[model samples]
Target chain A: MSRVVVDVVLKPEISDPQGQAVLGALGRLGHDSVRSVRQGKHFVLEVEGTPDEAELKQIAETLLANPVIEDVELHLPKD
Target chain B: MRIGVITFPGSLDDVDAARAVRLAGGEPVALWHADHDLKDVDAVVLPGGFSYGDYLRAGAIAARSPLMADVVAAAGDGMPVLGICNGFQVLCEAGLLPGALTRNSHLHFRNRDQVLVVERADTAWTQDYRPGQRIVIPVKNGEGRYVAADADLDRLEGEGRVVFRYAGGNPNGSSRDIAGVTSENGRVVGLMPHPEHAIEDLTGPSTDGLGFFTSVLKAVVAA
Candidate 1:
């Protein structure tokens, strides 16, 4: 079995209210050194044997992320 | 006129949209998201709700549903399609409309009666109202903020595709205070407010929303 990780995040130009809220909470909790925070979703997929890189990219682009407002990154095992 | 109201698994306002169509003197055909059939309806309404439990993102999964393929094809041919609230999200996700509806800047699920100005009355959905007319309708959503590329936003404004603009106050921090927008062909419209919920004075804050249904009926008949 192989695992692929997908990270979906809002584009930098778009506003992130949830991430801002979390940053505010962190400030209240006295995490002063933090500069900024942007929230994102992480998905770990377990696939049979070897995962196809192209299929994983398609899944990430078509479903895991919205290209209009989000960017996605894929983490795959080294061949 | 027969208007189809599509119901996804978690749709909460399909019945209300149908009721609005009936009130507008049109027959309402119920459509399912899992089917490809459009039921020969003259118009289609993508009603609001957390379809697919809003997984991944609001309206993301539902946008790729089977029925949406037909909806997109029909919309391309100038069939009138109205999407309300989550329906608006679906329309954007399906690429039937430009821009994306994102989380509200306030970070809360807001529900309230909002005022909007009809900026363009030439679309299939807004013909009943005069330009610059003000209407009160219930706005409800958690992720309703509208965002788009700056050039695209400017182009929409330049092309007069912005159908409605929030008046008095912006409910969700939408860019340019846009409450609703229409496709370039003017037959498809998607908005973040629940016009279905405001079709009747007895249950809604005002009867202003009836114009949307009535306008579409007129458009279909005229076409």
Candidate 2:
């Protein structure tokens, strides 16, 4: 089995409405010092069967990650 | 025809998406964000929702889901993929399609019935419509502004990949009034409007969105 890790981050300068909303709520709740909050997701997968690195990369580029607004990284642990 | 609807942790439209697929005469398969299997579906629909609670950006978190790995592979092998609303955001973020969705110029969440001009009818999700036809669908989002480098915009326009454009007035201040776009091969499509919500006249503003689903079915049959 091969394990792949995918990380998705928003592009700079793109205001995250959800994050901003959260920040506003936080301030309202008396939590200061949280200047900003940007949210993202991390995905880890364990694929059964032996797939080559090229195939894994293809998966990351095409479906697993959006290249325009987000960047992704794949990690294959050595057996 | 089995179509897969991917459900990210915060996905809100998978059920509606499945209903639309079923109404359009296709089976809807539920795919999880943490699963790698695509369930051998024919097509895939990345429904709009606050995936990962719209963290970092809309669709940014959900783009890295486990199922997306399989989705990317299937899309490359000619499997049709449609990204709607947040789904469209995910598609752009994932780099499956060009451009990025930014905050609405008004910096507010706008939701209303929107009129769209069909610019490209050859794509898998738009074949049922004629070029220049105008259809009304609902669009609701906060970060729905579409942006791209000037050169990229020119290339997208030059290549005829600008599949849908807003008519009458720009709702979200999208550049060039773009509402939807397709990949170079026309296999992948992403639109900012919610077609799944417009499939039924009684429930939605219009049934114009049904054509998108029917169009894909026809494309599959023809292929």
TM-score of each: 0.98, 0.76
Tens digits of per-residue lDDT for model 1, B1-223: 9999999989999999999999999999999999999999999999999998888899999999999999999998889999999999999999999999999999989889999999999999999999999999999899999999888899999999899999999988999999999999899999999889998879999999999999999999899
DockQ each candidate and list the results: 0.88, 0.17
In model 1, what lDDT does residue B129 have? 98
Model 2 chain B poorest 10 in a row by lDDT: B55-64
Candidate 2: residue B12 lDDT (0-100): 87
Return the interface RMSD of the candidates, in order shown, one decimal each.
Answer: 0.7, 4.4
Candidate 1 interface RMSD to the true structure:
0.7
Report the C-alpha lDDT of model 2 over A1-79, residue by residue, as the tens digit. Answer: 7777777655554555567788888999999989998766677878888757898888776656556555677777677
> How many collisions per candidate?
0, 8
Residue pairs in collision within model 1: none
Q: How well does chain A score by TM in each candidate? A: 0.95, 0.68
Off by over 4 Å in 2: A1-79
